[model samples]
Target: MIRKTDLFSGVIILLGIAFYYWILGSYFPGKKIVLSALIILNGIGLMVHIKYFDSYKKGTYVTFMGYLATLGFVLITTALELLEIFK
Candidate 1:
């Protein structure tokens, strides 16, 4: 079962990202743009999960893990982008 707190937390996390980007609308190029798009898509997927979280019998652990995994992926990709690893 999904709680209200969980839904709020998920929405807040995504809104924060959107706000951050809104405040800093720097342009990206090539691979970086693709990576950023991927991150944004991941957030959209998470919102879908948050919306229908209670429908799944085993949603709690799966949802939390998905959140963490996406966080880790974004962190790693951001670091790589900052360090120009993909270039």
Candidate 2:
């Protein structure tokens, strides 16, 4: 019994791995974008897994909060950079 959200997470992970070998292995022009995307998407998958299902076990608090804080920082900095304020 797989939920849609869990299926989506699995798809993201599979695509990430495939893209890693295919996009990063050869002379792809958008390698930088692919690399960054793989990193972010994998993290997003983990975040989704954390949020969508299951009870919070012990040791995952720091990891969860750190991922959230990092995401927030990335969003804020990206916004500022887009506005030409955080150069």
Candidate 3:
């Protein structure tokens, strides 16, 4: 069962991705700030989900894998931004 917070966070993440895609050809400071905030929120949501699983002692492996995947996503996204790959 996904919590409301998690669902909201997922929506934020999707919106952020869309915003980033939309702004790929145009550079704007405010858009960058919004993207960063959304990424951070997604990360926080991932952590919350992991913590919830840990507390319940269920699907620990899956949660750990999810954390790894989330970390990878963040790292890759940051690297691409730093490298200006989208620009």
Which of 1 and 3 is the better model by lDDT?
A: 3
The local distance difference test score of model 3 is 0.57
For model 3, the run of ten residues with the poorest summed lDDT: 78-87
Q: Compose the digit string of candidate 2's lDDT tens values, residues 5-58.
A: 546655664664465456533664665565566556656666765674343233
Q: How many pairs collide in each candidate, listed in order? A: 0, 0, 0
The window of 10 residues in a row where model 1 has the poorest summed lDDT is 77-86
lDDT of 3 at 22: 76
Rank ordering of all candidates by lDDT, starting from the highest: 3, 1, 2
List, residue by residue over 1-87, the lDDT tens digit for candidate 3: 976644654565565467558755567668667555655665666576556655434556775575456555645555554445334
Best by lDDT: 3
Ranking by TM-score: 2, 3, 1
Lowest summed lDDT over 10 consecutive residues: which window, candidate 2? Answer: 78-87
Q: Report lDDT (Cα) of residue 25, candidate 1.
A: 44
**lDDT of predicted model 2:** 0.52
Report lDDT per candidate. 0.53, 0.52, 0.57
State candidate 2's TM-score. 0.49
